[model samples]
Target: MNTRTGKVIVNQTITADGYSAGLDQTEEHPFGDDGGDGWGSSLHSWMFDAGEENRAEVDQINAASAVIMGRNMFGPVRGEWDRQWNGWWGDNPPFHAPVFVLTNHAREPQPMEGGTTYHFVTDGIESALKQARAAAGDGDVSIHGGATTINQYLAAGLVDELRLHIVPITLGAGVRVFDGVPPRKLEQVTARAASTVLHVTYRVLA
Candidate 1:
């Protein structure tokens, strides 16, 4: 949910208590394992080794024109690492299309070995969407989240669809996914329950 004027979709994992990011996402605690109280094993499995059914769903999600992420989610990794770090995934990333990263700091576009081009947007989400829509053409524009960024777009009623994976655990104190968003309704498009994850797809209904 980062584009108010254009088609925007949000995909994220949430806990029973509604936390998206675990407490403290610093370089050292990349996945926020201060005391291993977060969704450590479940998150890893869901993102990296989700079963064939989950993988197929992700593949369809990735077929969109562009992917968007927030600055915190794109922060430096492994102790003040250089921009060359690219991301957690090496060489060929899961996302094979253009990826838009929203940040206040500006940097040169980073192109990876695969077809992924990391375009840093210094302006706000709207600017990012304009470029994303142009790049996407007829495909959908997807918001690969961080809670704050998603809330911004949701407050403005920009999201076209939302694909949420609800894990069973609950982090009492952490980043809530739906914080600071205006009241809105979502029409459930699909609901699939897997052994490891509960997938709920919704079409934003204003």
Candidate 2:
């Protein structure tokens, strides 16, 4: 029997001003104009460029047994799934576990090269979290988001831990974290500063 309980955690990257993504998030610019050279050039440089220094954080993000993400984060395809869009991660996605995507449209489960399988949940955030938790078993269930989704979970008081990779730059207007989330007390767990990003972990106090 699986006696261990899984923690509901959120792992996201945001700008200094708390924007997870800028406006005009098209296929060409997913993260939009991030106030840098390109979309994710400066914001995500710490993950791709300074890999050695931010290895631990990278590992933590990938440690989840099940992941929950919004349809927007999954792909640019919207409204009835007109095309065959797997995800931005190509065939072998980073998460070698079940990934639950929140969407209004219904779609069949998409199995990828790795152990990953995309399960589209059209119900709601609660339903997605429930499915993710069941699939996760003893492992943690990660709410991997595009800010809007994370905000919904945060507002619902479902997140146990919040991990953020804060970049230096700021987007004047963009999709932000804690947009409609109610004020909740958080206890700092850890904080580490890398070359391009600052990693912070906080425990959502009840």
- The parts of candidate 2 lying over 4 Å away from their true place are none
TM-score for every candidate vs. truth? 0.86, 0.97
Where's the lowest-lDDT run of ten residues in candidate 1?
33-42
Q: What lDDT would candidate 2 get against the real structure?
A: 0.93
Model 2, poorest ten-residue lDDT window? 34-43
lDDT of 2 by residue, 106-183 (tens): 999999988999999999999999999999998999999989999999999999999999999888989999998888
lDDT of 1 by residue, 1-206 (tens): 55434457888877667777677677656557423533355554665666575886677677877888887676554333355657655778778889898877777888887799889898998898888888887778888878888888788777889888887777677677779887788899999887777889889898
Q: Could you give the C-alpha RMSD of every candidate to the true structure, in order shown?
A: 4.2, 1.1
TM-score of model 2 vs. true structure: 0.97
